[model samples]
Target: MTYSGAVKVGGAADVHELADLMISKVAVGPMNNNAYLLRCRATGEQLLVDAANEAETLLSLIGDDGIASVVTTHRHGDHWEALRAVVDATGARTYAGRHDAEGIPVATDVLVDDGDTVTVGRVTLTARHLVGHTPGSIALIYDDPHGHPHVFTGDCLFPGGVGNTWGDPEAFARLLGDVETKLFDTLPDETWVYPGHGNDTSLGAERPHLAEWRERGW
Candidate 1:
């Protein structure tokens, strides 16, 4: 899976690049939807993954490199309520699949499908369709400069549970199975897992929970 326009960071700025994808978590709702800003150390370009409900905090924290684009893992408002304001402030385009992209409260400037690549500096993200919670939920998978894979799982698979499947339970089940078999299966167990919300975890910690997940005990 590859998404186009991973976002090229502009060079020659005084910006202190966020080395190794500096992770920041801001509690954005009663439910605590976590928003992330992945900035390229080399280029200073940032990718806004799952903009939470507070546009002011996200904008200020996102910093001056200027958000190249915003991406939504799923269509949940908690994950993207601030997108409209973020887009207005940063003038960054929003990326998602055509069907669900429009649900982000702003125009989705770019449409991505499975295997499309979205590039940010040297990071290339491939969008994988992990439909379950929504009709067109996607997972962004890419390898960093260290070659360690990073998955920006937006509600598809959390540390202990998966996203709710209001649209289709069967599809949600398939999504769960697909995540276990497809995305997680392709990477090493030590790969970093960046979910839409929650503290960062590793594949090592999360993989073993699949059985419990399937059994609804996690």
Candidate 2:
């Protein structure tokens, strides 16, 4: 299916995106996790971002696209359960944060930090560290050809809910603060966000909820 209003990156039309990004909802898992397939629209340089609980299905979904890399948002098993299979099938380099790299639940080839950027086709994704959801959770920010920025937030933030937390309440508060100060404040309020799960939302819509989030003690 063609994207009705896919934000175009201008020159990449000639550069050819080796793949397309497709989202899948696997409901049988603990969470109805969303997995994204990053296939090069031009060269078919496939990549998988956070395989859901169904590792095998994740493998089949790529279906010989010759995946080149796997990027995980955090250490949760439900999010990275298929890392091993995806890596085995495509020999793709895996990227994760240093702290969670141990529980990455699989081996990885790249360890990233905030401010780091990775290139695929003509797009650039910069990683930002958001600590509330997990100590090592990272959100990726990228600008489309029109200069509009988009963020791929792992589990730190969601459409209507932020992930459940286990650490200090103050830290969880700080996580929300990070979303405000680092993410929502830094990008255009129009920036669209693709969270690890749930439907997409924009910085503009969610920006207003920061105060509400603070009031509820989430």
Candidate 3:
């Protein structure tokens, strides 16, 4: 229930730490949704991503420091199972992609669009709206002071290729094109990728397979 160690899809756990921020993740629910807790080291302000499941465990992880806000990656059911509970408990503001906000069961406080920034004390995360997986699917980009960018991709992207497009060719094309321009071309190879489920990967590791993924078209 608690975040005991780093979580991997099939390999070793990967942990990421930056100058003034710390990211801790736990895989929850039957779908193995990955929920993240980001804390500002200097201000102790925190942010939670997904709130996928296990409210008690998440609350414990949050503890007394409390949370500034909760950002839902997409409209998927697995991603917001614990959202209402966490929001009620912490009174933290809720943010979601504008187009996808209505899809979620709970109300969203702030409707974030592309380029919007969410701040937790000194830490700031830029919201990038990556469409296709859903009309408003989004990824959060954090430029770590230590080095490269860290992206919370949700289901829009992953290690081997882009997230499932559910056999929709048009959707696949949109997602792929956006990913290449918004993520691949823009971010460096060292950018870290954290998805809604499964292990983490880097832009460097997946960069080489772009053509292959494009050819395969998933």
- lDDT of each candidate versus the true structure: 0.71, 0.69, 0.87
- The sequence of per-residue lDDT tens digits that candidate 2 reaches over residues 57-134 is 667667765677778989988888777876877788899876678887788689988888865554567888888777
**Best prediction by lDDT:** 3
**Descending-lDDT candidate ranking:** 3, 1, 2
- The per-residue C-alpha lDDT of model 1 at residue 154 equals 83
Candidate 2 TM-score to native: 0.84
After superposition, the stretches of candidate 1 with alpha carbons farther than 4 Å from their true spots are 1-20, 166-169
Report the error of model 2 at residue 207, Å. 0.9
TM-score top scorer: 3
Alpha-carbon RMSD to native, per candidate: 7.1, 6.0, 3.2
Q: Candidate 3 overall Cα lDDT vs. reference?
A: 0.87
Across 12-44, the per-residue lDDT of candidate 1 in tens digits comes to 112212345544444466556767677766676
Question: What's the true lDDT of residue 146 in model 2?
Answer: 50
Model 2 accuracy (lDDT, Cα): 0.69
